[model samples]
Target: MGMIRFALAMAVLLSHLPLTNVKFIGGGLAVQAFFVVSGFYMALVLNGKYTDRGLFYTNRLLRIYPAYFVMMAIAAVFLFGFKASGTATLGMFEQAYTNPVTAIILGFEHILLVGQDILFWMKIEPDGDLVFDLANAPPAEDKPWAWQALLVPQSWSLSIELMFYAVAPFLARLNWRWLVALAAASIALRLSGYWLSIDLGLWQARFFPTALFLFIFGMLAHKALPLAMRLPAWTGWAATAAALTLIIFLPLAGLPDGAVRWITYVAIAAAAPFAFHVTRNLTADRWIGELSYPLYLTHLPFIGVVLTYEPPMPVLCAIAGSIALAILLFVLVDRPVDRWRQARAAGKAGPASTMAAATP
Candidate 1:
């Protein structure tokens, strides 16, 4: 499971780099795959480790925000101080903060990470008013997209993740039938947009409601954990291997991009419980898995810096630098915070074991 998580993070990192004609599961698929993984883990914890919803929320926040703020601070320095340009622009900042009300609202979103995802559905007018732009067009000479003000632009996914965390406990309590019904409804909504010619580009990927099905797939996977546990341990290893192979090689199989994506999602959802069953007890694997989140959060800044400097082997440099920074963050920030989070959970739920430490 850790290896799978790391591979998905790497897929996202590589996708963001300015590589040409590379074939792999893209950042979009990787993100959706991550949602599946998040769903599985949230189900794992919500069902077992968290008896108190308040404790679950706070532990989840601790898991996310510490490393996030550290990365956000680094991103702020690059964007505002050094004036790096990829994730955001100075013009976008000026437009965002031009009106006091807009500034306050955008500022709150940036700090709280609650509304950043909806920014994809809006654009900033020249007068600093935000208006709905379902098309999600690119920023023009006068109008800037509201999401452009995000210092860590990709943190939009975190907004989605936070929303999931908000309702996960309740969702985890549902019977498998109810869970399936909800997932079916969400998937129906996603398909209905395309069937009805609704042009749901803005909503399809970023919207929480449409994306809920992927997470529910994961929840369903957790419900299958007993089956996985009853299987031979080697089955877990086989499942992990098969899933990774599919992720890495499916693009070369000459399928439509959409088909490949759904295939990957189904493979991941099927493999997750088995993978987690095998990897949950391995200390080394868990450590590797811990790097995935910080790696995801911090990669964009390093990519921005590397691309700006135009170093030799820029892609390699970006990947190496991102991994190095991720390790530092894991060691310096995430580990300690995780200890506190785990301690809090232990206080509430008895002892905190590796199986109970599942995170997306």
Candidate 2:
């Protein structure tokens, strides 16, 4: 699972390179992969884990926040301190708007990864002339979509994932019949906006519900399957083929961007987690796992540095620098956090294990 995640991260990283737009764009498939795998794992773990929701949420909170804050701080310094002048002239600069209060709101939204309601204004440039809209202009008399607010573009998915979490507990308590109902609701959400718009929390698009359905499918699969049984060989192959085909051919067909996204998520949910589980058995001795977290944590800053400066620094140096940053982050941050999570989990697991052993 972690390797799949690493691969996805690599895909995203590769996609961000200035020159590799087309080839790298395929990396977006990785998130769908993650969602599928997560859906399976969550189904497997949610019931057991929810016995201690506070602890489950806490561990997740801890895992996500540290690296995120570090990255945000780096972005802040790069955007504010280094590019202060450029930002003042070209971007939003004043402390009055995106200040401490903003950060606090964004910080919570960061955990969920959606800041959709973070209000702001937009003004289309005219005649190539720069125009700044007054801060927080009231919506035009009848216009509901005057401006779009985005602190981080990636966050839209995160918000939907958080919505899933809120609903997960109810789903967890549901009998199979209710899961069928929920699945229907998800589909309805997806199709409701086909002619208009899907009201997927805040996205106002079909992607969220489409992806959510894949996730729900994963949950259903886990609940339906025997622990010893792999997904039927033919079912698995068909899904993998379908997903890959859509991903490769849909754009060429002029299908909406969201169509490929849905296919990718379905493939991911249905296959990736199981594949990762198999891979772990085959490559349990690999070295990448130890460095993966740190690598994930620090790679963005490394890319940002290169991109912010001499961006096209020959592919070799860029790769080297990224690897070096990953290695360093592991040595410094990842190892420590890993040890912390392990020790904490071990501490909690200890008494139970000992009691079981003693009882037996």
Candidate 3:
């Protein structure tokens, strides 16, 4: 599971590189794949560890926000100190700041991370009006896409993750049949975009409602955990290998883009439990898995910096620098916070501590 998570994060990094002709599992698919993983983990924790929703919510906040703020600060330094005024984030910030109301709203979204996903569905007019625009297309000359205002633009996915966290406890309580029905409905909504004249690229990819099915698929994978545990141990390794192969080599298999995506999704949903079952007890594997979150959060800033400075082999430099920063963040930030999170979950700290560790 850790290896797969790491690979998925790398896939996102590679996909974002300036190389125009390269093809692999892209940032979009990798993010959706992560939703599946998040669903499985959330289901696991809600069922096994959390008896109290408040603890669950607080612990999740602890897990996300600390590292997030660190990256946000880094982005700010680049935006102001380095005079990255030409960047979309800086431009968006400057334009939005001209209107006091827009500045306040966007500022809160940046700080709180609750409504960042809505930025994808909106645009900022030249006059600073934040208008709803479902098309999510590039705006007229001088108008900027609303998402450009995001300092950490990719944090939109974090907003989606937060939404899932908000609903996951109740979703975990549903019977398998009910869960299946809800997932089916979500999938129907996702696939209905073509006929409904919605832009599938933005809506299906970014919209919480349509993306719910991917997470549900992961929850369904969790429901299959018992079956996974009962299977021969070799099955776990085999499942992990198969999933890796699909993610890495599927593009070379000559399939249609859409078909490749569904195949990868289904493959990940089916394989995740087995992968976790195999890797759950390995200390090194868990540590590697821990890097994925910080890596995902920190990579874009490094990429932006390297691309701005035009270092030799900027892509490779960005990837290496991001990984190094992820290691530092994992060690300096995540490790200590995780100890506290674990203690709180284990009821070691106080009455607020009511749950147990769900994963290492």
Give the number of the best model, judged by TM-score: 1
Candidate 2 displacement at residue 328 in angstroms? 3.8
lDDT per prediction?
A: 0.85, 0.48, 0.82
lDDT of 1 by residue, 167-186 (tens): 89999999999999999999
TM-score of 3: 0.93
lDDT of 3 at 31: 91
Looking at model 2, residue 139 earns an lDDT score of 37
Give the alpha carbon lDDT tens digit for every residue of 237-331 in model 2: 45445544544444566656677566556555555434433333434322364444445444444555565566454454555676787776666
Clashing pairs in 3: 345-355
Candidate 1: worst-modelled 10 consecutive residues by lDDT: 350-359
Instruction: Please give the RMSD of candidate 1 to the true structure.
Output: 1.8
User: Model 1 clash pairs?
Assistant: none
Which candidate, 2 or 3, has the higher TM-score?
Answer: 3
TM-score of 1: 0.95
Candidate 3 stretches greater than 4 Å from native: 20-23, 84-89, 348-360
Task: Count clashing residue pairs in model 1.
Answer: 0
Predictions: Cα RMSD each = 1.8, 7.5, 2.8
Clashes of each: 0, 2, 1
Model 3 residue 199 CA deviation in Å: 1.9
